[model samples]
Target: MSSPTPPPPREVLPWSRFGEAARELARTVADSGWMPDLVIAVARGGLVPAGAVAYALDVKAMGTMNVEFYTGVDQTLGEPLVLPPLLDTSALAGARVLVVDDVADSGRTLELVMQRLRAGERPPAQARSAVLYTKPRSVIEPDYTWHRTERWISFPWSALPPVTATATDGA
Candidate 1:
C-alpha cells in the first residue's frame, strides 16, 4: 500500500521570541524617526502585536480595523471583508498612523485596509505598515518586518485549537 504524503514544513514563532520581535520592530520605527500619533491594529491577528508595539513606542492612541480574510491555513475568502465594529475614519484625519499586523501573507488584506483608511475626505497625514512576518509572494511590502519566510508559520497565539466549552455534567 502507498503511504500518505507528509505535510509541508512551517516556521514556528514561540511566545518568547514574539515579545523580543515586537520590541525590536518598535525600535525600528523609533530609529526611523517616524513617530506615529496613533497605532491601528488589523484584528484579530494584529491585536497582540499592535498593543506590544504601541506600548513599546509609548503611543497612547490605538484603534482597530476588523477585517476577516483567512478562513484557515492556506485558505482565504474571495476577497477580504471589513467586519462590523469598524474604526472611525475621523480618527485618521491629519494624524500620523501606524498599521500593524501579524503577517503579510498575500498583502491583499493590508491593501484593503490602506485603501479604506485613505478613502475618506480627511485621510491621515501619513500611514505606514508593520508586520511580524512577510511571505515571499506578498505583493505589498510592509514598512517594518521582523522576518521574511516562505514557510507557513505557527504563531504562539494560534498554534492551539480554539477553546471549546467544557461539559457541565461529568462523564
Candidate 2:
C-alpha cells in the first residue's frame, strides 16, 4: 500500500497577538531614525497595522492603496491588481513615505507598490516599507519587519465559524 500524505499544518494569529506585533513594528519604525512625512498603507490588510504605526509615530497624514490579489477559494494563480483613485503623488513629492502592510507573502504587492511610486511624477524623497509579519523565504524583504514565521497565516475572517441559532427549552 502507498503511504498517505499528511495535511498542511495550520497556524493561527489571534487578534491580540496581531496587535502586539503591530506595536512592536511601530516601535521598530520609531527607532529606525527615519521620520516619515506621510504614511501610506497598502489597503485592506495593511490598514489596521498602519493605523497603529501612524498613531505611535504621531503622524497626521495617512493614505491607502487598494490592491487585490486573491478572489476565491483557490489561493494559487494570482497577480497584484491596483484599485483606482490612488493616493495623490504630489503629496508624496520631496517627502519621506512609509509604506505599511500586514504581511509579505509572495512580495508581489510590495514590489508593485514600489514600482508605482517610482513611476510617479513626484515620488517621495525617500520611501520605506514595513510589515507586521514576513515569511522568511519572501523574495522581497521589507525595510522593517516585526516578526518572521514560516507558516502561512489565515486571517480571522477567513476561518470564522458559522453562526447558528440555538433554541432553549423552559420548564
Find the candidate with the highest TM-score and give its number. 1
Per-residue lDDT over 20-126 for candidate 2, one digit per residue giving the tens place of the 0 to 100 score = 77778888988888888889999877888888889888898999988887554337346799998778887788989999988887788888898788789998999
- All models: lDDT? 0.93, 0.81
Per-residue C-alpha lDDT of model 1 across residues 126-165, encoded as one tens digit per residue: 9999999999899899999989999998999899999776
lDDT of 2: 0.81
Error of 2 at 168 (Å): 18
